[model samples]
Structures are given as structure tokens and as C-alpha cells.
Target: MTTPHTVAPSERPHPWDRDAPHAHVDLDALRHNLALLRARTAPGVRLLAAVKADAYGHGLLPVARALAAAGAEAFGVATAAEALALRGAGVPGDVLAFGPVRAGIAELVAADVALTVAQPADLEAIAAAAAGARARVHVKVDTGMGRLGLAPAEARALIAAVDRSPLADLEGVWTHLASADEPDATEPDSATHRQVAAFAALLARLERDGLRPRWAHAANSAGTLLLPEVHHDLVRPGIALYGQPASAWLARRVPDLRPVMRVDAPVTFVKRVTAGTPISYGGTWCAPRDTVVATVRLGYADGYPRSLSSQAEAGHRGRRVPVVGRVCMDQLMLDLGPDGDAELGERVDLIGGGAPTAFELAADAGSFAYELLTRIGPRVVRRYPGT
Candidate 1:
């Protein structure tokens, strides 16, 4: 006799369950990418996955948890709040805030989050906030980024100051590469090479002076992929871990990385239009011939750039359809050809999967993958499959 079937409880609507645009984050792909990146580093060189900007808009906690399970040695974030959030989630691994902490210093110190001390004032503030507790810190040397790091000449003195602080633990030293993603980055005369040499010189000086920190890192994703010499003790990989090459040059060097995020939207409305009908705002694009216009529920507000209004294509059942007219704040129209078969409720690939990759889409929009990925707005639901 067949057993009685037990009905499962009705679950609440997930981000993907709603009839709207959603981002499908493939956790398996994320883990695979992490493994690939790990394989690129030396056996002893650790990897600090950069999860800043909500893991490049792929959801922070989910991405961090997945990476931790995949054996990430550490995580790099841009804010103290991000670091604290990781700790609150019980994520196992070191969480380093790449930016200097402006607030939540005591909380971060309590959470064991490693902070970046870029200046003397930053050190003073962190030491004061430590309250006699040992606060982990990584000193940031300008090296050439000219951003939030202390001058190379001043970095040595700061390291000494950190060592002298009873409440501070100098754990590492790192520098950001300004042009590591450039095409000629590996050239001896390139800015990336200069930065690497400068950082190495500083480390050498620190070693001679008995002031070298426990860890030294100066490689971003580009440097990790191309300049193995800069791998030093740890590598901070950001865009590469998200399955995006840091540059076109790096893409050619490493061609096996898989994209982790796929953005898709349901076709909310579809209509047959005449040749002269304008599809969206400003009457910018008039159909060249009788066609089927499908309205996708995605727009600039959802991180689909308005600049991609007339230049992008969406993938629908293996066919590339042109995006006609200006993309709206909440919707965009796709020209599905005169004999198009796209129906309402069907999903279209706006990015990744069968559509143009994020890199390609960013290029079409005159931007880069970093900006495109991080700009994915909150309105778009993020769903992680197989998490």
C-alpha cells in the first residue's frame, strides 16, 4: 500500500518567487571560482577575498559564507559595518576592513575584525578605542595609489608606533595597486611595476630595520593573475573572485573563470507594434519594421544602466534581441523581431548565462565590470541557488 502523502508547509515568497526581476547567484560557481583563484596562489600564500560592496552586489553574507566554506583565509571589506556583519553571522575567517574605520571602532575591535591604519590619527583613534584590548590592524602604505594610505616614508614610523601601542597588534602591511589592471601593467616601466617595486623596497627596509610585519601583501586581482612575484604572503582578489577579469589583458591570460551572477527579468508585457511605433521614453527608438516588443521588468534603478538603453541585447530562448529606445526607471523594451515567440511571464537574460557577460555589458555601457556589478540596486531581488 502506498504511504499517505504529507503536505509540506507553505513557505514565504523568496526573492525569486515574486513576479519581478531577480539576480540568480550560483553559489557553486562562486565556490568553483574561489577554488580556481586559490590554485593560482602559492601553497603558503593566503587569499583574502574582497567582499566589499556587498560582495560586488552578489549579497554579502551569502557570498562570504560560501567563500569561508570554500577555504578563504580572509575577507576584505570596505567598512567596519561590513566586517562586523560577517562576525555577527558567525562566518569563520579573518575579516579585514580595507578602509579606515570612522565609527564602530570599539565594536570592530571586540569583533576581532582587522582594521587598516593608514595614518597616525587612525592609529591613535584605534588605540584609544581599543580600551586595552588587542585590536588587529594592517598598515596601509600609499606605495603609489595616492588614496587612503600613509606615505611610504611615513609608513615605517607608523609601524613602529603600532608596535609600541600596547593595545594594537600589527598583523600585516598592504598597498593598493593603482594600475594593476591596465594592459601594460606588467611592463617594467608601468605604474603597476613601479608600485610593486616601491612596496618591495619598503618591505626590504622594514626587514633590515627589524620592523617587518607578520604579513605583507600588494596584489589585487590583476596582480594576482599576472604578477606572481607580488603574491608575497597574501593576495586580495576582488573582481576576479566574482568571475570577472580585472582587465581585458587578464581575461586573455585566465580564460576559465566562470561568472557567478545571472540577472534576469520576466517579460511582464508583450505587444505587436507597427514599424513606426516608439518603444520607450523620448521616442528615441522607432521600430524599423513590424515587430514584437517585449517589456522586461528591469531598468536603471535596478542597476541596468540607462546608457545601455539602445546598445544592449537580451537573451531569450537562445535568440539575441535588441533593446529598443531609452531604458526607463523601472522597465525596458526589447525588440523581439517580427516573428518573435517571447511570451509574457517568460524570463529574459539581461546579464550572464546566455546573455552578454557582465564585462561585455559594462563595455557596451562605457563602464567596467566593477561598477556594473556593484551598482546592482536593492530593488532587484538576489536569490542564491544551492546555498
Candidate 2:
């Protein structure tokens, strides 16, 4: 008799699974990227995993949980609501709110999420809302990034104001780098260096005024890997954690940054078309010879860009096939050549591991990896594997 066998309940497959389009997020790969960053960071510099934009479209709660397990010291979000989401998920880590205080300043204080006071008004609002509550905050000096940050002069005034407020706790001083991803960023007088120098000067002045925040951070993904000087006390890495290279320097420095997400769709139909037959809408692409066209179950509405219709290629069975004609809102046609052999129900790799990467698709679409990941539509379900 055969040996007695038992199938664990966990081994059972999903009941409603079928050929469908979905984005796969590898929890192991996410953990790997965070661990790589921790090893590369400067000594005593903590890691603040940037989970804004739904962890750059890799799923917020899943990515946050993985980062926490990988030893992330804190999380960085752009809004109080994003921070609160982390707290609601029982995410046990310091959440630093880096965006401007548009609203809900008190709610952030209530959630124990730190704030980035970029202006005097923000400080006043936070101080009023934080009355009798120790409101943790990181003063955001503009430095050189002309975005949502207080200028050096204004930052000085705000720090002084915070000093007078009993409800405020100056936990950190931080800035955003504008060109740390650019070439020659570390060169003398480069924009990246200039930003860091400006931030350093502000920190010195604050110290001289007898005010000090325990945390001082400026390095983003690029700065964290390329410039050590900007790694003041903490580094916030965003795209890199999701395994997309944040900069050319990081790509070269850390060669093992594994991409954690892949877009996959099942081939819905395969049809043979005669020569001169136009494919898809607009008749833009006509077959030069009899060809087999495979239609996959993804479209512009699913985050597959229309711009990639004629410019990019999708992967099928370890082969490359050009996308032909206009990408419809619900489907697109792939020119599989005369001898192309994609069977129905076979999985097609649109963007992800061992296929045309998000970077490649972005370059073809004249965009960037960040847009590709974040633009993936909500209609497509996201599956996390190997957790």
C-alpha cells in the first residue's frame, strides 16, 4: 500500500483562480532589497523606508510589514492619512509625515506620526493642535529642492518658534535632495553637493543656537547609496525598496537589487491573419506577411500604456513579440510573427522578472519606472507570494 499521505490546508489552491491579469509582488524579494540597503548604509545611519504612493504601487500594508521585519527604523509617508493607515494596520514603527500640513495636523499628533514642519504656519498649526501633547516633528529645510520645504532663513525662524512651544518635540531636521540621482552629483559644487552643504550649514546654525534634533537626514534612495555625506543619521529609500533602481549609481553600486513586482496576463485569443490585414484599431499596423497575433487580457485601463502599443514588446514563452497598433482600453494585440506559437491560456509576461522590465517599458513609453509601477490600475488584483 502507498504510504499514508496528508495534504495540509495551506497546500490547497485558490478555488476561483483562473487565467487573469494581475501584478505579483514577491515578499521575499522586498525583504531582500531592504536587507541590502541596511548593509550598505553608513554606520549609525538608520533606514526610513518610504512607503508613500502605496509603497510605490507594491501594496502598502504588505510592503510595510515586510520592511518592519527587515529592520526598517521608521516609515516615511507624504500625508497624515497614509501614516494613519500604517498605524491602523498595527505597523510598529516610527512614521514620519514628510508632506506639507494641508489638514489633519492634530490627527497626526494623535496617531503618534511625526510631522515635517516646513514653515512657520505649519509649526503654529502643529503647536496649537499638539497642545499638551508631545508632537514629534522633523523640520524640513528647503535646502535646494524648491518643493515643499521651508527656506533656510524660514527654517531658522521655525526652529526658534518650536523651541518656544512646549507641545513640540524637535525629533529631526531633514531636507530633500533634488539632483542626487543625476550624473556628477557628488562632484564639487554639484547640485546634490550644494543641497547637502546647505542642509549641513542649517544644522550647524541650529546647534549653535542650542537647538538639536536627534535625527538629521537628507539622503533619498540615490543619496543613500551614492553620497555618504548626506546620510546624516537616517536615509529614506523609496523605489529601491521595491527593487527598481533609483539611480544609475545605485544600479552600479548594488548589483543585486531584485525587482519585486511583475505584471502578468493570460493570453485570451490567438488568430491567424493574412498579409495586409490591419491589427487592432486605427489600422495603423498592417501585416507584411501572414502572421499569428496573440491578444492578452490587459489594456491601457489596466496600467498598460497606450504609448507602448507600437514601441514596446511583451514576453511570451521566453520570446519577445512586438505590440501592434493601438492598445485598446480592454485588450491589445501582439504581433507574434509568422511562426509565433502562443497557446491560449498561456501566461504572458507584460512587465516584470525575466521579461521586458518596467524600466524598458518606461524608456519605450518615454516615461520612468516610478510611473509604470504607480500607474498599475486598481482593477487588476495584486498577489503577494512566498511570504
Candidate 3:
């Protein structure tokens, strides 16, 4: 006869289970980044934190709330829906939808969310949607970025049109920087410098014509960190606020910024493989000698780049281990030498958390940090350990 054994309450599986992967968001690091950015700008220059694309995949509402509490003067989003979501979540201060707003003009106007007027049609739609209510509008000018916004020559006519609309309140005028993150931004012939000059000339013309809006801004993360002259009235810092440098130049310039999110996944299986044994698909990697391999519960589908297959490394037991073989859709294998002792359900640091930072991982994948941060899929659980 054998006695039955019951699992203790503490040993039982958590609600998230043992194999769940998490993106641990450090709210303290986020707040610290915001303060560092604030310190870089001059007094009276408002900080507009870009919380678009679900706060760059760091959980929008929570990141926005943390930023709002950290003294961010305004929030810049890509769409009216994102702006409305922030308003619904009780995020105070200004919310500007800088992207194109083909629909939801009425809802945005009613919600008091500022809409960007990039063209004459956008101005017309916003004015019509205002009805009897006042609509706050920002005229976007194409300084150098030829994607959106009106040409500098065409901006005067649009500004005049906005001035004529009874329901439209011309609150701001802004432009996007094209090469502000490039190393040649300081050169006189560089695109960034030309754009800055062009925008300044436009703002001066508007001021002289008495058509200048209340706010005249043209600065992204790189611009905010590198070009103080371009920080006219506001600065929009996106990736930097999330604690990732916008580029190598910014990283070298601002070395104090800390990464706010760390990706972690649990090891689901551990096994010893014989020499010359192939791992994962296509036999891309084979063991040179007998070694231990650990399978982690994270993959390309969870926003880990497939290009990082056999190129990246993860942290295990305070040791750096090479990611072996091609990464599958739901799992990746790490080579832990013959003496390795990683067990089932052991945590592995995929990115950050004292391991390889997002910048390093992104470089290994031949991509940038912005793409990696935003590409994080919805399946990964976001955990705020110290909110």
C-alpha cells in the first residue's frame, strides 16, 4: 500500500501557469526616463510623450498613466481611436492625434482631442464635424519629410482657411523631422538642418503675418535629444521615453537612460543531446559536442524576430548562452553546455533585465529597437512588478 501525496497550495500552478512568457515593464524606469528627457528640454518647452501603437507595445493605458503622473504635459497618438482611448482611461492633459484622421472626426471633436490638419481636405472635414462645437486643430507642414503634411508653400493657404472657419481654433503648427536621428544631423547641408531652417523660416513668416498658431513644434526623440534649437514650443519623445535610445548617436549621447521593459520566458524542456545531433528545423545548427539544450516558451509569433534565429543570446543562470538552431513559431532552443543545469520552468531573460539589451538584440536581428519593441505580440503577458 502507498500513501497518496497532495500538492501544496504554494506549489500549485499560478493563474498564468508555469510556461507563460512575460514582458516585465518597469514603471520606475519609465518615470526616470521621462524626467531625464524633461531635464534636456528648456523651461516652458512642453514634453509631448508619444503613446501611439499601444504605447509601443508596452501596454498603452498603463504607460500613459505612468507618464501622466510623471509630469508629461501632453500625449501624442497616431489615431483618433488611441486619443479617445486615453481620454476614456482618464489620462489628463492634451491628447493630439497627429496621424491622419479620415473617420471619427465628430467623436474626436466632441471629445476635445486635437486633430492634425495635414491638408485642405482634413481641414474641411474637421470644420464640418465641429458643427456648433469648437475644434482644436494643428496644421502640419512638410518641412523635409515628404510623407504627410502640406508643402511649406501651401501651408499659408491652409492656415488662412482654418482662420476663416468659425468652429476651428488654430492651436498649433508642427512638422516631422526626416533625418534627425542620422549622424550628419549637425551638418549645414544635412536634411535635418535644412528642415529645421525651413520650419523656422515658416514659423517666422507666420508670425510676421499674424497667422502663427499658439504652438510651433518640430522635434522627435532624436531631435529632442540632439537639437535644442529645434525644440520650438514642444518636444515629442517616443522611444526615449520608453527607455530605449532612438539611434546609436542618441545612445552614446544619452547613456544614462535605462530600458523599461525586459522580456522573460520559462524553459519548458531540458535534454542532453549527443554530438552532431541537429536541433530545431532545417538542421541549421548541430551540436559540435554532447551538450544540454533548453527550450524556451517564446518565439517569432510572440514578437521575437525570426531573423534572430541562431543569432541572438539569452541569459540563463547568470550565464550568457547562444540561441541555437532556427527559432520556431512557438519555441527556441538555447545551447547550455554539457555541464549546464537549467531545469524545467526556469526563467530565461530574452531581452534586458541585465542580459543583452533591446538594442543589442535588435542589432543581431539586423533591425532597430522601435520595430522590436512595437512588434511584441499581444499574447505575451505584460507584468508591472513595481507600479
- Residue 5 in model 1: lDDT: 13
Inter-residue clash pairs, candidate 3: none
Model 1, range 215-299, lDDT digits (tens) per residue? Answer: 8998888888889889999999989888988778889988988899999999999899998998788899999999989999999
Model 1 Cα displacement at 73 (Å)? 1.0
Better of 1 and 2 by TM-score: 1
Candidate 3: Cα lDDT at 88: 77
Alpha-carbon TM-score of each model against the true structure: 0.95, 0.93, 0.95
User: After superposing candidate 3, which stretches have Cα over 4 Å from the reference?
Assistant: 1-14
lDDT of each: 0.87, 0.82, 0.87
RMSD values for the candidates in order, in angstroms, are: 5.5, 5.9, 6.5
Count of clashes, each model: 0, 0, 0
> What tens-digit string does per-residue lDDT give for candidate 3 at 120-153?
9998787777778888999999988998988888
Off by over 4 Å in 1: 1-12
Question: Using lDDT as the measure, what is the rank order of every candidate, best first?
Answer: 1, 3, 2
lDDT of 2 by residue, 81-174 (tens): 6788888777889999888675887778888999888887887788677756878878888988999777887788887777777888888888
TM-score for model 1? 0.95
Model 3, residue 226: what's the lDDT? 84
